[model samples]
Target: MGAVIRYTTDGSDPTESSIRYTGTVSVSAATTLKAKAFKSGWTPSQTATAAYTMSISDTILFSPASGEYHSEQDVVLSCAVPDAIIRYTADGTEPVESSSPYTKPVHISETATLKAKAFKSGWSPSQTATSAYTMSISDTILFSPASGEYYSEQNVSLSCNTVGVTIRYTTDGKTEPTINSMTYTAPIAVSETTLIKAKAFRSGWNSGTVAEGNYKLRLPDCITFSPEPGTHFSNQKVVLSCSIPGTKLYYTLDKSEPDKKSIPYTEAISVSETALIRAKAFRKGWSPSPAAIGSYEMAIPQDCIRFMPAPGTYTEAPTVEVSCECGIPDVVIRYIINDSGSEDTLYSSPILLSESATVKARAFKEGWTFSNISQGTYMLKVKEPVILPGSNTSVTQQEVQISSETPGSAIYYTTDGSEPAENASLYDKPFSVSQTSIVKAKAFKIGWETSGAVSEKYTIKAAKPVFSLESGIYTGLRTVAVSCETPGAKIHYTTDGSIPSKASPCYDSETLVSLSKTTTLSAKAFKENCEPSEETEAVYRLKITTPQISSDAGGFSCETAEIRMLCEFPDAEIFYTTDGKMPTESSSVYDEPFLATGYVTVIAVAYKPGWEPSDAAVKHIAVKGDINGDCSADMSDVIAGLQILTGTDSAPIRSDYDYSEADLNGDGRVGSAEIVYLLMAISKK
Candidate 1:
């Protein structure tokens, strides 16, 4: 017979010495349990073989922890228990067995809360698991061609990592970009230099930071050579220039390409020998121009017969003199106008050239070969136009007039810096110039060549000076400061109500002007190259001393209390009001002593024509000896006043009445004098 049973959780056979089997055997995982029945010395029964398996419910686990995310999320749900089914809800609701089963990863492109649970066929459902995700757009905007300098026009494109993001942009540098700005859909055409600011926005994501891209598009103009490269019989002066203002020119004389490291051309180049010149132009915020090649061929100088007054333009009729420079004796000089044959006139005196012509001349000696031919091209251009008021001058306004020395010459003008064309505005009469401007005028005639343009610049008035203090009433000594917004301006000021001029006192910015008495300040701003600014005036009225009341605020005993007012300034007029109203200029003037009766409040103020009014002075007067509240001075009131002073009274008096009636002399105290005054007031009553 079996008395006890021994068991082993391992798969080995159970022996007599194996552990005794308890009420229950705990198995964390699948195990084979063997048990045998045994008694004191009896042989152990055959081991009973049994396999056990365990299954424990586990909570659902999310692939990623709950937190904020910048992009879309692919969430995965799992469970520790094998073959357990996981269910989840994305709408912040509890997950049940009837909810959508978790088969694939859940897609979370926006902010949402996901709750899930794990369940099996024969196991209890795990605790509810919760996860929340907050999504936002963190991708920065990208601009094509980046933010850099460009020589030509650019087509800019905008992009973001997000697919459905909208980009707003602004070309103006003042306004910050918002969702309501210009939407970037297609490539933007940037023809000029500008600053582009942009921001990205999405439906359910936060807006991105502003991105700035600065694009510079400037193409420098090519260089131009004066007198054109050609063959000449005299030394030629080659000048390298550019159409754009403030552009620097670099050139090489050995027919090589020119760059920034080449020699800069500042003046005209004297080309005596045959050489090739190449030049390029450079300027800030602009691309370098292409190389300009000019080849100049030089020849011998034609100096045999020289023409006087040079071969240049002149407004008046010039007397051209032709002289022979041959070493031989008895040489003759002959000249001809425009392609005329050799049978021309012989030179005797200077010839007057009233029109444009090319003079060809030669020297001849009877025994020697004929001298080389000399040619001089004279242009006799039209007279230059004259501008009134001159150049580099300043005025408030000017009437601009243009005139030419030659009659019947038409004048063309332009305010901009461009050269005047034949179809430009014709200047027939004087025009009014009220603002700063640059005027260019040119004269043209049908017979003669057009004259060179005359340029003039005029500046308008300077900015008005600003005063730190406004025109109002002030007190005590005040320090005033003046300023001018126009740079390099000088400020002049006056304090005697007079207009300021150059001769007035100049105000230094580092120092402050002081004023002790009432003053009317005037200021003006002036500069060397600008007209003086308009006069600015400010009236500073000093305050007058407050009036003083002659009678004290205590009681006074008489038929009527005499009240007087005084001021420190003798010229100040004192005004008073007895109806408890504020005193003004229209109040009664205290020229002499005034009398007041009954209970009254006297307010007085002092005023002057060009000064601020003084603070009001107040005085309160009560009916004297009226301790019994009868509004009169009598024997019974005198007894009440004596009782108040002696500290033995049957009826207590009102504090306001007691204070006023006790002190009859208005000395701010009550004593024997009050008693005597009260007795005298009773006699008068």
Candidate 2:
């Protein structure tokens, strides 16, 4: 750059009409400046060019790094400069000054190139930035036995295309998780028309796309009984048939586990007593055929069924017997374990169950009605006691730990001064506590009374209050919120810079902090039976001030006048009004000289924000004569008005008063009527 460079504003070759380079040349919009170096009649140098652009918005920056994305994205476009307007377009094109301004955030619904720019007055337009967003699916799901009708209850398995992703499936047709819809880990049982929707999830990545299908299961191959499965006459020979082929049928006489060792069906046995028949088939490499059941009452007298030992919790399997009318000869008993209904085991002798079970049985004999069904529920014994860290009352301790002395016990806790529950928020790790917290814990085993609720108390110290807004300079009215980490702490605050106490304006539920004038807000947090937090403060300074002009602005007689404006605040802008409306920040800014033609009133105000606005400065100027613009009216002007009225002079009335303050009537012309009106007005004065 040269010190004596001549620049052309009209985009032409630089000549004597070019301006001498002094400091910086500001433009309200985009411009190209062509300059040539020249010194004392020396040969002019080659043309140098510079371009500038001033827009309403600044350049934009995006979050979450741009890439091919499969799902909706809340793309936030932001600029570094305050008060800068942002504009954007998804369609690639040059943006103008009046483009769409950035509001909250840009939502990219599909693949597109997002172009944005920032603009503000007095600054060169920023370079445009672009982010290309493309739709993508991180993973797809594959459902085995994909949605459709089936002959029976079907086992369904689902898999995700991508590794390291967790799949969640929903059978309730709702997007949110429920008791029935759960995270997928193994095969699921489907017995009805279920719309199974699944989505894949991985940390730090957008949730994968959702895939859904419907499934239905029906049972058609049920067992067929030759003699209907109801009350039957003693000595009735009933035949059982299975619909599935190549199936090995098995049956049980004593209510016990039926395996290959159980009795095999070679011939139909004559029924002398009541018998409840249950059977199932098995084939290699296939799920065991569906178990079939039938109940038949023989036409004979029988007694109620009974268990040998009482039904209660036991350390080991109990040798339980299904006994019925002991003197009845050749009576048969049948029972089902755990209500599984999987098999009708014949209870011919004492049976020992290894696990918990609810057993139901009946006895039948030839020519006898079936005995009344009897049921019993037995539970295994409690394993051991859980010994977890229990009571604590330290001011610094934030959490209490829990563990089980027995390997299989689970711990539960509560903190809201309420009784602990097994389904409360799980205390898997240490949690922060800032106030008096009553924590109750309990250990649970499969068969044990949960260890007496282990009660604990944590006495916490006071924590400092945090402000939603940091202390800084603001332009307008602002609202701030106060928050305490302590659960039950009360916030007290002041605006006069006084130390806050219990008597100060206490914030019980209110969180809003409204600020209009420059102030320092101080606050403290207090809680009963606990500590009070340290006093903290924040300062907010107001920045807008009223504007001032060069003069007090009263009546003035002149052909034309120019006014200058000023403000005390840094970077404050001045706006003015000719027509009497309140001056706002959006009013016309004081940038260039204004021509006051004829009689006029000028009102101006100063504004920024965060500061008090300055009072309006009004200036009034009046020009009475001098139509020729020599600053005075005499015989020549009288001659001109008459000449024009008499058709002697062809000059228009507007030529003298268009840009000069000479028209006394405030009209747009200096014609005969205006001249007569001016003479009469001045005569009265």
Candidate 3:
């Protein structure tokens, strides 16, 4: 028997040849078959290929041919032949006809392995293919400084592992993963809170869900100070903390970032002066936290106290108060009075006064003279009163007097008379008084009753006259004038040097008495009710035989010459001189009138010696040129002038020529025509 091959073709087959059979075939109705046989060493045999209908089973399978995908990544699986049908199941099961057919690429949701097969009618099930598709997780989450860590400004790299996957990320958690990601490089300063996420993707693959991370951005550790910024401090410290949790604290007072070796905060610290402080809190993969601000001031003790006093003056005993309040509570108060004189303490107590003497006060403490003698006062006392009365009756013009009833008893009297006492009467000499009347006086004794002063209204008189001139030898040629004065008395006087009697020449007032011979003058006065004062005399020492000249008969011009003779002393004989010599009896006397021509010297001498001589006197003369006696010279003088026509040089005009005789033309000056007329007149005479 030969085996029979039975196959059905509905355009779904593995091989390209048509279905073939051999030998006999039994077939159901509605089936069509064609057959062929193969025999060895002989011609092929043909058999009856019957047309019979038979049922064939069809299977479906689905798979991801490109398997093992990251989450939400695309995958593809194919059927065995073009006529085969494909289906898929996400539950990792064989696909049935009811499942959706794999008409396009499939996507893997998670890590998965899938089986897929092809199916055709009247064909054996295709060999099952196992495909491993894995949904990869985006395990590489880019974390800056981690969430609970403190970090300073630093760089961090972010990455992920997934084949054919493009990554997208967000730091603020506001964006999803995509091919275009808002990415950043390393060295992100963690100055604030930040969130990080990433996703993976490729073509024909869905983007993976974003993986998230939390971190806190932090700044560098910094130290701050109150009241002063940008300053350094020594032994300074600050509180160390972080913006994130579970971070270690570290600090340095220098200007360096804090490290593990830096000092950690446990308690408060004392800062002496300026210094820098830095601190940082850190954890794994996180930036360090910033430092805290710090400031401090130390307490100091006071040094010393000082005081000063204002300036002032002291006239009498004076006290000034000063105070010092400073550093310490208790202080020593030391003072010196009159440091220039003595540095001894005047008073340690509160009261310090300038005594009756000049003094300066100073304050000293702790090697310092805080208060100086910038001002002071000198004390002066009033002098005692000096009593000046020396007599009880009338005080001398400037003298005062006091009287005592008993010896050694004091007398007191006030010129003002304000009081009377025993202690007031030590009079010194040489006092002055203005009044001419008496002053009040009283006498007092300690045990005896005070005696009343004999009050007499005694008058003060003017000083007596003292004679200044005395009897003396006499000069013979000069007259003497005498004078005398008695201040309050009228004086009477005589020239005989006799004691002045009531009948002597009385001078009711000051007078000058002239005398020519030796004589005596006596002066006296009577003060009120006092004795007549003695006489005062000044002798008249007169000069004898004094010469004199006649002031009226001295000289005139020759035209009007009229000579006169008179004595200087009408009571004495006189003489004269013509040749400018002293005169004697033989000298010519002026018995006649004469004419003069030019200046001539004439001297007159008194007949007695010891008298003054007259100074040599000169007379100027001129010719009378007017020949007419009409007191004028006009045409009427020509008839009289022609009568004396002589040629004599001594001719006179009408023999009685005067200044009018020379005035021929009625003019005063003399000329030659007047002289000719005078010569003619002289010739006529």
Candidate 4:
């Protein structure tokens, strides 16, 4: 279209000095080309310009292009634009902006599909790039006889899914297998506990996961026992066991080693008394475990027998009892009395011992030995008779009584001083005795020996003599009569204070006792075949009457007063004293009336021979005009005398005039005589 054309390889406007365009401009890459048309003629037409850009393919590029791979691959995705972002999805899903952005290469280990896309800001997104990948890794290595426990040696083999794959292995659990590790050729021998690991390798395939296994091969465990090996009471149930499963246990009751022929332990075994037990364990295809020995000894407790009311003497018949300690069940207690060879009797109750005997007992059971013999010796005797109102005593008309401590026993007694025999009189009732006697008694029973003789002496004393008069003061003589209750009792008397005997005076029915003086009369009674009665006595006072005083006791107003003393007993002498002293036999004798001049106290006593003295009689005298009894005549007494004469103060004067103190003339009343005596007394003063 133009005569000549010029173009620029860069993105500049074309000029004349630019490269001239030839036929069909070819650019190795994208470029902006320009051309200018020119000729010698007038103005050239507008320059032509064109931009040349290479087209980028939307399909992704891959290195080592996707195909089958024996090993894992790292796949990369890219865009032609340097600043384009590449997002990828390896799970065969359509890629989006939210997919994982590709920064480094993506690793592929298994069969998978990878898709990718490129995006830029304000630019159209590139089409999804897709690729398919396949992986060929060695199949998991296999092991024969998977990990477990075994009792004996085992042959372990290693294999893989790929036929004839080269497999490297390691027996130690710590080291992992590599191609340089041990090579697997045949089966591996495993004796003790071990762990086996292996890995498979080929020229192009990758190695599989490390194959691992553990094998335990050893001997079976030994047998054991419950309640192992010791002495026990009663019985024991021996249980045998082994630690390993499906193992057989054998045991023997006797003290011998156990073998396959011994008793197989299926249930608990019973061991009674003293015995030993041994056990062992066994299994097939393995050596027998070590022997387990259990020595069990059984002991039985001893049963003891005892006797109640142990070996001792008893006063009366005793009941004996026999028993066993803690009382053995279903055991028989046998006993024999007095003789060892006698027939045995089963004891159910206490044994009655009426006589002396030796009791022997033993305990018997079915499976146990007889207990030791328990013997007791008992000597029995009758109790002696008791005599009522016991021995060596005196009594009057006694009735004797006898008894025995042993019931239902006959008692024999004798009145003489001899021992009682079985044929003597048997005491039936109380017997009366008026004379002294000695009682001897013994008790007798059927099977028991007679009791020892008991002697008691009873002195039957005669009744004491009694007097008709009692002992007291007497004014006249008395005749005493003595009497005795016994038939032939004799009475004796003594006037003196000595013990009365037969040599003393004998008393009759009538006897005179002198009462002129005080006397003590004693008497005693006696009889044949009886003891003498105790002495009895009577005392007679024969006291005289007390003397009488004829004068009044209060004040005497006269210058002199006449006092008289008299007694009822005509022969008694009355003695007196004027000074208020007690009158004895040596005092002044009272012959007639006496005179007292001043204040005087007359005390008198009457006495006679063989008689007790009489009590004293007293009289007091004072001056006639001394009305107040002051032992003198004065004006104060005169005024009292004048008061007694006048009737105006008669009440108070009469109270003070008791005992006729103001009766001066002894007329029993106060009058002009008392006033005249007081005036004469004042004149005399």
State the lDDT of candidate 2 residue by residue for 260-351, as single tens digits. 56677677756666676666666553455455666676553434677878777765557898777545688888898877859889876787
Candidate 3 structure quality by residue, lDDT tens digits, 206-310: 455667766655544443333443433123443444455556767677677668788876654456554455656666654555556443432112222232223
Full candidate order by lDDT, most accurate first: 1, 4, 2, 3
Candidate with more favorable, higher TM-score: 2 or 3: 2
Candidate topping lDDT: 1
Q: Which ten residues in a row are the worst by lDDT in model 1? A: 551-560
Q: Which TM-score value belongs to model 4?
A: 0.35
Steric collisions counted per model = 0, 39, 53, 8
Candidates 1 and 3 compared by TM-score, better number: 1
Which stretch of 10 consecutive residues in model 2 shows the poorest summed lDDT? 382-391
Task: Give the per-residue lDDT of model 4 (tens digit) for 1-685.
Answer: 4456777777777666777666888665567776776655646657677766554356677765888776668987767776677899988899888899889989876678889988765456778888888776547777788888776678998888664468899988889999899999999999667899898876544456788989876445566777777755446777877777768888787768888999988898776655577777777656667667777754222445666677776667788888777344667788899885869899999998878788887877665445668788877778878988776545466788999988878999998868888889999999866678898899988767788889888887877888878988876455666777767888988876678888887776655544456878888987777888888899877777888987643443446668888897868899999887999989999989888766677899998887888888987675555565565556766666666556446432323223354566888776777777777766765
Q: What is the lDDT of residue 532 in candidate 3?
A: 58
Give each model's whole-structure lDDT: 0.79, 0.68, 0.48, 0.75
Query: For residue 33, what is the lDDT in candidate 3?
Result: 53
Model 3 residue 343 CA deviation in Å:
51
Instruction: State model 2's lDDT.
Output: 0.68
